[model samples]
Structure formats: C-alpha cells, structure tokens
Target: MAPLMRNRSPNNVPNELNVEYYRQRASAGLIISEATAITEQGQGYSNVPGIYTDEAVEGWQNVTRAVHEAGGKIFCQLQHVGRISHKSLQPFGDPPVAPSAIQAKAKSFVVYSDGTSDFIETSLPRHLKPFEISGIIEDYRRAAARTLEAGFDGVEIHAANGYLIDQFLRSSSNQRTDLYGGPLENRARFMFDIVGCISREIGPGRTAIRLSPVAPSNDVHDERPQALYNYIASQLSAYDLAYVHIVEGATGGDRTYQQGPEPFDYAEMRETYYRTDGSGAWMVNNGYDRPLAIEALEKERADLICFGRPFIANPDLVRRLRINAPLNALDQRTLFGGDAKGYTDYPVLGG
Candidate 1:
C-alpha cells in the first residue's frame, strides 16, 4: 500500500485504516506487508510506514493484533530504497546513498511536500562512505526487532526489486573497489552480512529474504546473473532463514520473463537451496496466477507462491481462488495515496 499517506503524526505511522485494511484481507495464508522503511534515509517516498518510532510501533501493534484475531500470519518487508529517491524525500535533502556514485536510469515514485505524486527523474546518488555501512546494517537489525515487537510471524528482508540490496548485489550498480565490489563474492558480501545480522537478531528461522536473479528495474544489471543468484542461494544455505523468496523472473515482469542466463539452469538455484539440506522453504513470485501457482507447487518447483495484484481488490482472495469466484477490478486511481474510498472499501464476496 506504500503507506497510503494516512498518518496524522509528524512521523509517517500507520493508523486504523492500515489495521482494517490488513484485517479485511486476513484470509491470506501469509501476508507480506508492503516494503517498510527501517530508517529516515530509507523512507524514500511520502507517507510510507517507519519502524524506528514508538508511535509507529504502537500503530503496527494494532495491525498485528487485528490480523492475528483473524487467524492469518504476516511478515513485515523491510526495504531501504537507497538511491531510488528524490532530494525532497531524503533526510535533510541529502543525496540518496548507494554502493557507488551513480544515477539510476529509471524515475522515482515521488510524493512531493505538497502531497502530489509524480515520476521525477532520479538524481545522482553519493557513494556510501565506509563508516555508514555498519549503521545501515544496524538499521536492518533494529527494524527486524520492531517487526517481532509488532507480533509478526517473521520479517522479509527486501533484497529484491532493484533496491539497495540489489544495487550492491549487481555488478553494474556496484563499482565499489573496496571490500564491497570487484569479485562476485565481494559484491554479495553486503547482502550476506546484512542477512546474518538481521537473522542473528531475530532467529534465522524467523528471518527471510527476497531476491531477483536478473531484474533490470531501476537500471540494475549483472554480467553473471545466474552466478550471483546461485552464490546467494548457496551462501544463504548456511543460515536457516524462514525462506528464500525468489522472483522467478525479472521482478514483477512477465511470467515467462526468461529461463535464467545462458546454460539456463531452470532449477539450479532451487537445487542449490535444497543442497543446504532443506535450509528453508522456497517461494516463487512475479505475475503468478492461481493455476500456475498450483502447477508449480505440484511440480515441486516452489514451496509457496506469492500473488501480487490479485489481492488488491479481493480481500477474500483465498476463497475466491478456491472456488473460481470472480474478482473485483481494483480501480487504479486510488492505489497510491487514498482514504477509505479505495483502501478499506473493497468489498468482500458477501459483505
């Protein structure tokens, strides 16, 4: 929901609308919240929820309580937008931070100070100073702590969708010559370290991460896509995260986006995860439909499936999919920032 711009406090905290929104959709077996900011620098857009404040924690407590009452499991997605931000959205107008100093080719989803949404051209980001990296890792750990305090089943580290983690993981975006760049092993160090830290804070069994092997969004690319992802799966095998959520193709792109890089090992990454001796559940996402999801599970391609857009208008999505019921066409106009008109007003099947 990208925060829904629904805070009455100075901090962008979730309110009752956020609670009721999740409550209404509690039929979902596992609800992964929208990518939430872990720090002010990470709050890349207007009104997204923050986990660093007391008010934010209490607000989330209400949401978790509601979802639990409805018998649904939820995981908070911790995301740091890094360079995909505008000066207006940054902390004290600081230049957005990335692994290196580079301007992304894509535009940012910006909400101006005057409360207007616009696609602004991304600005050049400053290379992260070595001193700042440790603090960012702490940010993830603290945010994961808050996720547990909010009574979530676990936390999903947002290492996908060309965000900060993806920026560091890909060779094109990360030109840092220090320990963070050059070799594939070094490029993935940031993710491994952050994951290790977060997992340490909130038991590895309750810590999870999402990654995209070859997503090109936000001007991200890698010379060895398969190598990077395989390394990721292998390294993560050492830690028993709740799951390794993978976007089967370019994140949120076509379902048949691609079969992987040359040599196209369709299930190589999957095999790599299993090689960990059943380290964690394997999840597949990106443009998945109901039938495809079932087929993938039946074929043992995935342990769980993540459906994105379908849950927008269908609060009773589970029942609808189970019985082949019709779905509501979510009005896109009210998607980004809105009140009850679109957020909490989506009717259930018989409600």
Candidate 2:
C-alpha cells in the first residue's frame, strides 16, 4: 500500500481511529504508513502524524501493533516538507527551512482555530545553514530509531514529493555552493547521508527510500534528471536496501509527464542499479491499474506495484485486485482531514 495522508491525527498522534484503520487493511502484504513528520520542523500538513514526540511514538506503537496482530507488515515513511511548509505549521511560527531561501510555488494545508482548514500558499523559507543540516540528519536518525521502538517492520525515507530531501536534490531548489549543492554528487549528498544514517541505525535490509526522479510534484526540477537519477541509482548500490520506490511521471497526475528535455527512462535507472550491484526490490507507482501493473511485472519492469487512492476507498484492496472486483468509488470531499465516514467505514466484499 502507498502512503496516503489522511490528516486525522489531530495532535500529531495516531488515535484508536488510526489503529482500526490500519487493522482493517491488514490484508495488504505491506502497508506504507502516511508521510510521518520526523520533527516539529518537518511538519507540513495539519493533523499528519509525527514520529518524534513520545506521544507520537506511542501512537504509532498502537498502529504497528494492530497491523502486526492482523498479519500485516508495515513501514513508516519518514518525511520533512522543507519549504513546502507554511510558518503556521512550523515550530514557533518560524519560517520553514530549505536548501535555499527560495519559496516553492506550492500550497500547504493549514487548519484554523475554528476547526476549519484550507490550502494556503507556502511561506518563504530561510536557507539552511551548514550546521543546521547535520541537526536535521540527526533528526532522521532519531526518527528511524523511533520506528523500531514503535514496532514498525521497516521505514521508508520520504525523499520524494519536493520535501526536504527532494529540495536538496533538485537543482532548481538547491543553490548552495557547499558540499551539498553544486554537481549531481553534491546535490545527492543529503539523501545519501540520510540513507546511510538510517541504514546504520536500522539495518539496510529494513531501510528503503522513495524517489520521484521525473515527477514535478511540489514544483521541483533538476536540469538533468536522467543523469542525476541514474547517478543516484548507481550510488544506491552501496546499500543493500529493502527496496527502491520510484514515482513515475507527475505525481497524482500524468503518468507520461516528462520533467526534462528527454523522456525519463525508468527501465534505464533500474538497469543502472542492477549493473552497479544494487539488489533491492524495484517498486513503481503512479496511476497504475491491474493491467498496467501486470504488464510491468510480466515485462520484468517492476518487482512490486503501489496503489495509492485505490487503497483509500478499498480497505480490502488486495482481495479486490486478486478477484478483479469493482473498486469502491473514492469520495472526493473526504480525501483529507476527515472522520471514519470516508475512512475505515468503506465496506469490504462481505463485511
């Protein structure tokens, strides 16, 4: 299952509602939890769960325990939204941090005191100092450690979606001249550092990462995506990660969208990883249906397929796919910041 932010954790702590939610979908072989904040500084959307605080960890403990008890393996997706966040979401209303001070052409979800929320323009961000970078990396390390404490089967670093890690990797977002921003290698330093740290904290076999090479989600782009991501795939060979999850094309949009002059070749990226001895499972996501997913596996293009929204409306998505049953229609009005009405209330085949 793909990570989909339901924004139901009012205090950044998963509640009983959350535990029941995951337990219902425990049929999924592996469920990737929603993008979870690694620190207060990493939060972007309102009500999204966090992994830093003791309460947050305790909240996730319930989630993982329920999933495990129901026979499901789950991974927590650690995330830092960087400049994609608004000051309202940041600690003490401070400006969000980014690779550069540039603001993203994006919006963030903010809930007002009146119990209402709306998407607001992301605030201008402050450039991250060299010293601050290490602190954030440490935050990721701590988050990874917390995942084990919370009883997660593994963890996936949210390096995609124009978040903090993705902000550092994209040339358009990163303008630093230091060891973290010029060439492809420099731009990828932050990612590798986080991956290495997490792998050390939790074995690489339990560590994975999600990347969106060509997806222009959160308004991020690199001059040479093909070259940049190909290099990343090769470098990833060093860590025998659990898997490499790639978001193909525009996230939640066009599946054939290209971010550069040349069309991004996902097959080439996988080949590069394999040639360089990266032996991780290759997972692909983005507008996939049963036919497309089967075609990918049959053609040996992907080892696993991720369904995001489909899982939102179908708690028994695994069985639905297996039997080729018609899926429940997603309620557009209740996609985020909602109760069980559109969440765990979705009926299954016989329930």
Candidate 3:
C-alpha cells in the first residue's frame, strides 16, 4: 500500500520507490501504490508523490523495477485530492481546486522539519468551470500516460475517499445543475469520461478504479449511497478494466460508526460490482483479516483483498496468510504524517 499523502517524510521511505521495501513485500499478487497526485493542484497533503512529473515517474519506475525483480506485480493509484487540501500544501500558495468551491470538513496532517505532525484546516477550493473541468480530465490522462511510462502493471484510479471524483459523485458535495451534475448519470459522467480518456492512453485492460459506497470519510455523505454506487458499478461495467477496489468500512471515520448498521452492507455492495458473469475483478479492503478475506474470496464476493494496517505491520503479509502465522499490530500514532518509524520499519515475520 502507498502511504497517505500528508504522512510522508523527507526520508521518503514510503513515497520513494526503494528496493528493500518492495523486496520484502513482493509476495502480494499485486501491490497498489498509495494515492498519487495527478497534478500539483491535485495534492492534498505535503509530500504525497505525484505522477505528473518526469522525476516522479523515474522514481516510481525504480519501484516498479524493484518489485518486478522480486516477482511482484504493482499498480499505481492515480488520485486528485479535490478540496481536501490546505493552502500550505499547495504550490505557490494556490488554493485547492475542486468540482465546487466548498471546503471539506476534514483536517489534513501537516509535518514540520522537526518531524512533528499537526492537523491543519483544508482550504476552500475554486469551483471548476466547463473548460477547467475538461482540463482536469486531461490531467488524469497525462497521469495515466506517466504510469504507463513508469512500467507499472496497471493504474488504479482513486475515485474513492472523498477525493475529486467522489466530490462529483456525492450529491452532498455536488450542487451543480449543468451537464456534469444534478443527476446520477451526470455526476458519474466525469469519472467515466476520465476513465475513457485514460483507457486510451493506456489499454482498458490495464486500468482500474477504487470506490467506497457508504464511507463518510472527509465529511462526505451521499443522499443515496446505494443507488449512486450501483449506478457507478453498472456504468463502469462497460469498460474492460483490470479491477475495482472497494473500501468496505468508513475509510476516514470512527470504526464504531463504520461497523454499525447502515443502508448499504459491505458484502452486498461488493456484489454490485463483482458479479459472477465476469464484469471484472473486484478487490475488497478495510478491516479484513485472513479469515474474512478468504471468506470473501471463497464466496466470490471479492477477487482480491487489500490489507492496509496489517500490511504496514507485516511486510510479509502474503506469507503470513499462507502459513496462518501470527500478525503484528500497527502503531496508530505513526500511521499518518510520519517518517519511516512505522512506515517502512514494520518487520517481516521471523525477521
């Protein structure tokens, strides 16, 4: 897993494509890099890696080579933070840009030169016009082209976690009445269009996307989570993408609220996207252990499973699962906005 944007360190253990790190966890069928910014304005926090730059592409290419040398497959997650950014994080003190000008209620982690972390309020974004919106789609295409140049197995478009795509998908955030909003199809249009553009840059078989149905992270709420995601899944079915990853629980909220009774169930939600008729592969994430992951795969609910904190604490996660070995616990304090202390220092089993 790629580290969160703001949680990066100057050492760049997580964001940097290091040989040792990828060598350790090369067992995963496919390792998706942490959310990568599509542009400088797409950044949400300090030090989150960008895919738009030649240097960034070179850095990630080193990572891809490392993983590939170790017999591992990897994908880069293309992300745009939308309004979930602080002015301090933007280039030249520019404000964050989004589908709307509203400010996200979430606080981004800010790191200091001393390696300390603090929460900072997100800046209000400048709402994009029709022309600017088209520009953003081009941004995604460029980012996807870079990912292909970097030699990654594929690219996972991060439409989840209250980012740019999510901002347009949710009714609570998108209040526009134009062709880009007001109806479910219009809201999903931006995503589908971006996907189509990116697919042209890279083959559709090498493209993927991640979505969250009921996640209330970053203060995002939808009027109809079920219908919204159902339509999204159905619409996405037209593309011959690699797979779709879904975060099952509230990705950016309290665990209690996420596990509570909600209109959408995680298993049922997975079924919406991963049908047996072979629409595409489906990957399920959030709070999954070996047992739960195996169960999901057994029941055909998920084709692959992504483990976040578990992978952080256990670099040999695939081996641990294969042998049913004991797992390590992650240090929550160092989860975000940290150096390599908890980022790359997590030990492999018996190491």
For model 3, where is the 10-residue window of minimal lDDT?
9-18
User: Relative to the true structure, how large is the alpha-carbon lDDT of every model?
Assistant: 0.80, 0.93, 0.78
Better of 2 and 3 by TM-score: 2
Mind sharing the TM-score for model 3? Answer: 0.91
Ten contiguous residues minimizing lDDT sum, candidate 1: 1-10
lDDT, candidate 1, residue 136? 95
Encode model 3's per-residue lDDT on 202-266: one tens digit a residue. 99889989887777878677877777888888777777888888877587443334422454755
lDDT of 2 by residue, 47-135 (tens): 99999999999999999999999999999999999999999889999999999999999999977878898999999999999999999
The most accurate candidate by TM-score is 2
lDDT of 2 at 153: 94
Better of 2 and 3 by lDDT: 2
What local lDDT score does residue 43 receive in model 3, on the 0 to 100 scale?
79
Model 3 regions lying over 4 Å from their true place: 1-6, 9-19, 113-115, 252-262, 265-279
